[model samples]
Target: MSFQLFGLPVARGVAIGRALLVSSSRVDVAHYYIEPAQIEAEIQRLRMARDAVVEELETLQRELPGDAPAELSALLDVHVMLLQDELLGAATKQWIAERHYNAEWALSAQLEVLARQFDEMEDEYLRERKADLEQVVERLLLVLSEGGGGRGRAGGLPQLSAATGDNPLILVANDISPADMLGFRRSVFTGFVTDVGGPTSHTAIVARSLNIPAVVGAREASRLIRQDDWIVIDGDAGLVIVDPSPIVLEEYRFRQRSGELERERLGRLRHTPAVTLDGEPVELLANIELQSDAEAAIAAGAQGVGLFRTEFLFMNRNGELPGEEEQFEAYRGAVMAMQGLPVTIRTVDVGADKPLDRLSIHELRQEQGLNPALGLRAIRWSLSEPSMFRQQLRAILRASAHGPVRLLIPMLAHESEIRLTLEMIDRAKQQLREAGLAYGEVQVGAMIEVPAAALMVEAFLDRFDFLAIGTNDLVQYTLAIDRADEAVAHLYDPWHPAVLHLLHHIIRAARKRGKSVCVCGEIAGDIDFTEVLLAMGLRSFSMHPSQIPALKQKVLRTDTRRCSVLRPARGVPD
Candidate 1:
């Protein structure tokens, strides 16, 4: 029988392989009480398990490929921290001694409490931390149950490799941890599908880095997929066909070959400059979220990073903000890795969709009837919280000394906000100078995302050195649609007349001011819109690393002058 499932398309590719269902081992923990005499031994056993898990994670980190994405190493670091958490260590021991429970039982109890706390979190990103907590606890339980010797089945991935017998397999799981994915890094899995995780989840990021087809948020994929069942995964379309018939399989096989041929053609253009047919050069850059992404960006021929989102540094950890030094190290690392290419670092854009639990604003987030997207966020949040803003600004300033670094303020809508942000940057520079710190001259830029920001182009042009249009948010706000809400996702159209008008105005205004303009949003990566954007005088584009080659190919074939002459009118098809 033929059936299909839909999910969020994350990494792009196509794969047809037998299903390999890998179930999480966390739910199989045994629980029991312990005798008074066994309490000390149980505590000792817990300590040994913690030590062993830490050792295993450290070994995995060391064994990671020299060129592996930095996020993998960072994920390992988070796991190690969770294993050594004071709550997990101290509270579990307390539970064991006072409740007379065995080590595994005590650990499971504490994990339940922690999981409940994470579940209560309103922010989806923070709520996902529950999975990390479970992953760490599961590892400890495995170590304790197996006498601290065995590898706990490698998250059931070894079974996939053993059953396939040289045939490719698609892994289906409720969720996959970084460690589990690492175990199968050298395996013969052609793709993966998960019941959980969004486009920006760590698993999706890792899958993209490994160039594997992946579909996530496929609820119940693991529950429905049986081992060795024929399956087809289309990562580009977010479709999974199970027990596919001969006809569907043949169609996908044709698509798979077409995709491979196109990729091969694009691969040959990696070293080519993104210049138009008329010999005009366009600056092609990458929007990076991690230091490891910088390597991939450069490898894909990105001139530099046009948008380096710093928000990832603020997520997926316990309730704590990264300090100034930590922020500085991250910014400096990206700068150094770029090898002098310009790196635009955007300040924390948390609010609405992403809430930081450690900040006082988190308490305010609990207030009913609050619209996060419109509420205090981006530059608005930064201005409201001067101290935190200053810390990030100081870190960015210190990092500027390393190489070409630019400051990009997000969600700016008013002259007042721009003025305040400039004042804050000046104050940070003063603080740096007073401390006798050496810093390079960093250009300041503004993200023209808000509709108000797009309207008040003169104010921004008069203030900032350059401008970057974030079409993703601009279109959503302009069209009064929430792109993340699937109920209205179909209504979120970038080609809408209002959106095109706003993009045209922003690009023309920036050019009039003689300031560089770059598009660092999803639209920038869309090959269909490349000619339209070029016709509108957009000279720079920043997108995902994987998207560059294809866009560059489009750019090379584009004749901007011809596009301008043949540009479509409002409500007219081109």
Candidate 2:
């Protein structure tokens, strides 16, 4: 009989394939204590392993497919940075010197220490990066286990299965590094399941970029499925079926064909304007992390770029943030790619989850016991580092000359923050004038992810040109539940009564003030809530580019006049 295992549904579509199992890396470790006299040799061994992983990551970066999503390359670069981080390997050397533990034992022990710190982080994105850390450590362990010579492939898993028939190979593993995931990009696997990972993990992100059907955090996916077993993967439902019955397989296969046809039909809507049946126009925009991703947004027929997460550009550069010219070129690339479409560039939002490359996670926690989400992040972090903050402002203002650009400030909760932020923008403009640089005017926007900001929308509208609702943080702060935490993730509801009321208030206030407001969160991408959002008076939505067509279809079928009809049933209030 076929059995089922469920996990987090990361991407869409159904895949029927034969299993290809990759073993877990956290195994077969020798934990004997080493003599003090042997400490130097053991430490050198760790150094060689770290260096080897760096070489491996660089090789993978050089070998990334020409068509690979640019974000994938950034992830690979992060892995190399992890290898160089003293927190990861340098601290382990301390264990060897003090406890006299073997290199493997010391490394794994250090991982446990750092993982606890990561677990305490408030940002879902940063918390999910623990998977990346584990994957990096796993690579180091692999090299040490194999006597300091790591292989091109991971865990001896083949790059491509021997069989490439109608039944594709499904990768089932404990975890996968983005680097290793890139290596398998051009392989026979059509879908995958991992024993670990959340929606925001780099692994899941890469899977989505590859357009592959995937499920992550299936605790037993690797242990239960045998090699070559017939399996069915339901990416939408986050389900994996092993040795599926013929009847069941046929059902999924039919559904798969139907999904393909539906996609083809939706593809026809790309050129159609997003106007509701009642003649109300809605703006559909794309949220991007990289300039190269702008092409994807254009391909999906986005009206503009809504959220350009600039932090990815600052990541994994071995402690050095990009300078103004480098940052300007990146912002310019996205602006130029949009070809007259406005691009909203949010300043780098780094906090506990997205610590600067040089920031020590352990030291910060020890020093402040800070909650990564509530601590220095977004506008707060930018304001704290005024020079770095000014560097970013100058770049965005410079990019505006290329085309329309919006300078969005994240996490503004006070009048003082608004004043300071505006002063900084004026300062950046002044600096540009002094330097004789060409720049253009930008529509400055405030991100309403902070409850305080949402509650005082009138104040924001008084000072800012527009408002962008970041529902991800709004929902997190409203419910006090971290979506990345497995224990509380189930309680992380975006449709909570409080969240709905908050959304209603923000949209209503923005409209009353005659200010443009757009929801640039995960909720904007979900088609199920389309009518409800419109019912709540929303006219603009920003989401992943892949989500544009379906959402456009939803808008086309909806009647703005009847949006209130979604009210009582969904518990929306006046």
Candidate 3:
């Protein structure tokens, strides 16, 4: 069988061999209905589905071929772990139990909730993670209904299939989840093309991690692509050509060869230092959310952990608040895993798009005002809830005893906020001291996420130990653009003169006071802007651990003095 599918470009250079075309026919189930109370039974039913998958994963692991591909084994490990991950399982169970929804319905409803929240997120990168979550849920549901006995094996049972020779199989899906990507047996899969997902999607991340050529945003690839069809996936150009002609195949083959050569050249850069043309050194650090990400950073040659988001700890089972000790353990592990490298943990900046289960949605809406970007959030929220602040502060302080730790107060618009945060830190330190607990002397810093904070950098230069520019929020707030609204996503440009001006001023202020300035935003990871940022006197950049290698490559090629020639539209320095 032969067919073609195409959409916006995503991955490039796809390997091809035997392909598996999964066909799904949508069912409009209006007649097969259950009672309202039956929803309760359905809740139990969904848990059974989860249990079934978990058991299937275990059974398959024990049954797979002794020579199963390493990629497939890695994928299996992720699936097994995902079946047990507290976040996904708990969220799924909650939706089913509380709403009496079917497994699919529960997954869909949870996606809707996360999508809505992410839709309100001010950070484009963080906001994009919602898509990853959606893809994961979608994959899980597919395996639940269609996969035989848990594995998506052809026999509806645990089985291992290998692609003949080195021909890569094309992966087609409506949405490929992280677990699905992890479950992929590398020998059977050469490239990936999906109907839903973006560059920031989990599928894309996995593809990139494995150096597999992939293409995404192929709206009809899942519906059109059949097993064993010749397909070309161009990642750099973001194109997918289905059932490519002989000439097209030849061209792409040449491109693939060229790409491999280029990649080898870039690979050698891993050993190079991120120095400029003038030989000035720049520190490239990785941003992380979990301990699992640390290894990736180290492998990528990142100097240290730059931004450690701490909100994951606060998000509890079924959206409830996690205990203080639970938060401490999470922070402690991340700090110690860094092996004494400085890890700056940004305090929970939940608000607007990200709601805390402890607070009512309505109350949050009110406190956030008409504009969330301009509303009560980050340090403001922590200031209002002293107890919450104290708990986190204490955990961070205690973790400092294990490794180098720094506390970053987000959305610091006024000096008073910094003072209050400092006061809270003191209280936490005092309490720990009185209780005879050992804690390290942690550095206190502030996030320049607000416009007021950006312009008033000089006022705050001496007030904090360090400054991290949160370009995502700072740009959104500065331009009065709601980044989460796809309708206006185009307007949320990080290169806007206004944003550049703010960054210039903030960096200048920090340099004047001899305080370290780092940017923990998406822009920091942009390979194209590495030179521009270096010229602007940026000493450090914090981004996803996955981005470390490429950014480091950029840094090593840049000349700090050459980058300095670039000037901001506003705030002309004397």
* TM-score of each candidate structure, all chains considered together: 0.70, 0.72, 0.63
**lDDT at 396 for candidate 3?**
83
lDDT of each: 0.80, 0.82, 0.66
lDDT of 3 by residue, 1-574 (tens): 3345545433445465434343232311111123465656665655666777767777888888988888777666766665566666778667555534345545544555556577689999868766555545555676556633222222111122341223455666666534334345333566777776545444554566456777666677755554445677777766767777777788878888887786666666666777766877788888776656677667676778888866645543345666578778888888777777888888987765454556465365666566554566678788988887898888888888888888888888876777787888889999999999889987788899889888788777767889999887887788777654434544667777777877878887798889999998767876767766776778899876656667777776766765565553223332
How many clashes in candidate 3?
A: 19
Query: Candidates ranked by TM-score, best first?
Result: 2, 1, 3
Model 2, position 535, has a per-residue lDDT of 95
Model 2 C-alpha lDDT per residue in residues 1-574, reported as the tens digit of each score:
6899999887788988877565334454444455667889999999988888899999999999999999999999889888889898778999788766567767766776677688789999999888899899888887887874222333233454333234477888787754356445557788999888766555676676566899988988876776557889999999999988888989999999998899789888999999999999999999887888899899899999999989878765667889998999999999999999999999988764456665566257737865667777789989988999999999999999999999999999999999999999999999999999989989999999988888888899999999999987898788876544445656778778889999999999999888899998877988888999999999999987888999999999999788788777787787
Candidate 1 residue 186 C-alpha distance from true site, Å: 12
Leading candidate by lDDT: 2
Better of 1 and 3 by lDDT: 1
Comparison by lDDT, 1 against 2, better one: 2
The Cα error of candidate 3 at residue 211, in Å, is 8.4
TM-score, cand. 3:
0.63
Better of 1 and 3 by TM-score: 1
